[model samples]
Target: MVKKFFIFFTFIFVSSLLVSKDITLKAEKEKEYTYKDKFMWLWEKIHDPKSGYLSVEGIPYHSVEKLIIEAHDYGHHSTSEAMSFLIWLEALYAYFTNDWKPFEKSWEVMEKYFIPDKKTEQPNMKYYNFDKPATYVPEYDDPYKYPAGVIYAEPVGKDPLSDVTARYGYEMYLMHWLIDVDDWYGFSKYAG
Candidate 1:
């Protein structure tokens, strides 16, 4: 009788475990399915094909580090932090959607103009060499001289490190699971 009771309890426990596992997996799949639909909408709304960067209202504010879209022609310059968010967002979007084209395009633009020309410069500082040229220009007929800084004249100013540091931290923290551990940078000592 005791043996039968033990077998019955074991069977019940195993069955409950299987059922709960199925439910959990189904919930996750449902969540992803919903997000996939919304991702397409977000892509259409935020993507700026002309500049290869997300914009406030279909307008490119390349001059400033940041820009705020206003109701009228009134707005403020966006911070470098905004661009950093966009980079991380783009990577996250690609990871979820399995689409690398947009991420690749955006990264190319950022790498050219924003990824710092020297170690002394801010990580995400916007300054490309005027003499040379970037590989991708959304639309430009001139020699493509925007603005940049050397070791001293960094555009983002005294506190230029925050945005870049945040970006690197996120990339290093998450990309290991999404991509490859080898593809990501090591944990930043300066993140503190």
Candidate 2:
């Protein structure tokens, strides 16, 4: 009778283990399903498809960085950092779902506004000589003497990335350091 009781106890324990295992797996599957839906809505909130950019004041801004900074910046402001996060998140979504559209959309919107057009922004770019990218100035130890001590007389090294820049034909322009999302700080073109 004791042996029979021991076997019955073992059977009950094994049954409970199987039931618990199914519950854990169901929870995991539910979490994954929720995340897939989240990625979809997140893409909708960040960018404007109508204007095809993360826009400001009818002017197309390349990133959503400035707005985030305007909200709260913890003493550091960087558009590249913001863009990096946006791109990374999109890539992660793509990795999980095997969908590249959202990733490509983020990159496209960023480049469309961030990168300066060679024709519009740099009309004189073609005349630029790669051999002399810039005249070098000597470094000085003293802060007061620095400006006076500096001389732009040395020949600069040939620009190594000129070809690469030319291949892409777009110069990155990270400017308007702070984007006033609601025109809160008065960076807007429109005067109130």
Candidate 3:
């Protein structure tokens, strides 16, 4: 009787060990998705191929439409973040697949939207002077202090990058912060 009991206990322990090993193997299999595939998932969720990521005039709404048409509000931080992620995703895709078209396309889209073109957007940039650049405005800790206190009377140093920026047709390869999309508040509320 004692010998039979010992044999039965050993068989049960071995069976459980095999079952646990199988379960672990299955779990690992489920996580076998490549890093590139994982990155693609983010693009699938937020991007529209035709319109390109819930945008307005090529500027992503941070991502809300003017009339709450979509689900976001205008913010440079949000759009910049999304734009950056898109470029990185495309870069990873190119690395994994060795197809660089998508990566180039991502950069093109980012430049077209965020970095305003010189001739079209900056008409008066030619008049810019390094010595008399826009008045200096110090960063304020208080929220209400801003869009005021522009410190016009105070003298400011000459622009260090004026020479370099002039080579690019006086156009800055930078993305300025946006307050709204489609001029929703201005033309709709102020005009007409």
Candidate 4:
């Protein structure tokens, strides 16, 4: 009677462990599917060409039109606020496709929106507070200055080759480096 009870308890413990492992694996698989679904959904909404340029919902690409529409829909009409999502989308696309075209396009739009004036002074600055701790505090305010400038050729037609090099040169470089790091490791985000 004692031996039988011991065996039964051991079996139950092993089975419970197996069940827990199975549940964890299933949850991870579901999470992957969810991530892919989100990527696809956003991609489709931004790249649909026709409605894409107009910034309509359910398009598959990014455009000023979509950005404006999204801002108004969300009750914030600021262009910078709208482009924040656009920047993230551009980064995501570059990370996934290992292509720089999306980043270039994003840069073009950003230049048009932020730096439409060609005669702006060099090293023009823009500030973004990321709401994080300051690891290093500067002695002077100038040390904290973040320069914002546009380096793209003036848009003439459909050709973006020249503007690509001028506008997004630094961004393209940083993105290439970041993509390599992300591919090597990984990242996480909370529920959106």
Candidate 5:
């Protein structure tokens, strides 16, 4: 009777340990799923391919038509705000879907327009109206007078290194992480 009780107690102890470990692992898996679900929900909500951008803040416009029109009209061609946001969105979408095609498409468009000339090292922020050549349009149509590399905060686009550059730096850091991925965008070490 004593031997049987001892064996039964030992079995119960071992079984409880195994059960607790399984429960912990299950909880961890559930947590991961919950995180993925939240991201997927945001992707569904803010991803607007028709507008060629993500809303970022998840502000809902009246309609998809309105979103597209707003993006087309107000989207900056040169600012890090415009380019980095798009890159971030594309990267997230690709990460979620395991599809690189969308990111690749956006990359081609961004490479052609958003990235400023390395020689000038300035963001010209030229708007490439899809199928048209990237062109800089100053308020007065005087591209030659506009400062080349610095981010201007003033109305005339002349002020350099504005407060918005902080946002740009952050976006660049995110892009560095997103694009540094292997076998996706072709691993390139981003020095900046």
Candidate 6:
């Protein structure tokens, strides 16, 4: 009886340990599944060409360029520039990845609607008038002629004008910064 009891107790303990191990394995699998789902959700939202503009969630590419142009006319400088930059960046990514559908769409919009008839000439002075509001312009001493410091010269009070180059340049810098940061953080583990 004593021997039997010992064997029985050992079996029970071993079985319990096996059950716990299985439970842990199942939990880990579930966790992995959940993480994968979250990743997919984030990836779809960020990279989906059809819905990927900075504002106007889920806007089609055909309309994105028109929207940016209108935004530029309306003096929504930041929004217009950001949308254009994002579209271009997305196009570049799609091209490299051999996903030409989004790239084509973005390019069509850029070509049809967003491309300026002419690039704005750089201001001779480091500073240019931001608007009616009197603000001192910052110096652009760099050889590349990239505008340094704030883009806007002054508050502009109630009135504003869309400085196309300034807006686009600012947006490009910001988008590059964000992509670099994302790469650094290992969020974009795979380079597309």
Best by lDDT: 3
Q: Give candidate 2 regions above 4 Å deviation.
A: 1-77, 97-101, 148-150, 162-192
Candidate 1: residue 149 Cα off by (Å): 27
lDDT scores for all predictions? 0.47, 0.60, 0.64, 0.47, 0.49, 0.47
**TM-scores for all predictions:** 0.32, 0.46, 0.57, 0.34, 0.31, 0.28
Score candidate 5 by TM-score against the native.
0.31
Residue pairs clashing in model 1 are 66-77, 66-78, 66-79, 67-77, 67-78
Pitting candidate 4 against candidate 5, the one with the higher TM-score is 4
Off by over 4 Å in 4: 1-34, 50-78, 118-192
TM-score winner between candidates 5 and 6: 5
Question: Candidate 6's C-alpha lDDT?
Answer: 0.47
Error of 6 at 155 (Å): 18
Backbone collision count in every prediction?
5, 0, 2, 13, 3, 0
lDDT for each residue of candidate 3 in 136-179, tens digit (9 for 90 to 100): 78887888876656779889989877878767657677764432
- Selected candidate, larger lDDT, 3 vs 4: 3
Indicate the TM-score of model 4: 0.34
Better of 3 and 5 by lDDT: 3
lDDT score, candidate 2, position 69: 42
Error of 3 at 177 (Å): 4.4
- Please identify which of the two predictions, 1 or 2, would achieve the higher lDDT against the true structure: 2
**Cα shift from native, residue 130, model 4 (Å):** 26
Candidate with better lDDT, 4 vs 5: 5
**Two-way TM-score contest, 1 vs 6, winner:** 1
**TM-score of structure candidate 3:** 0.57
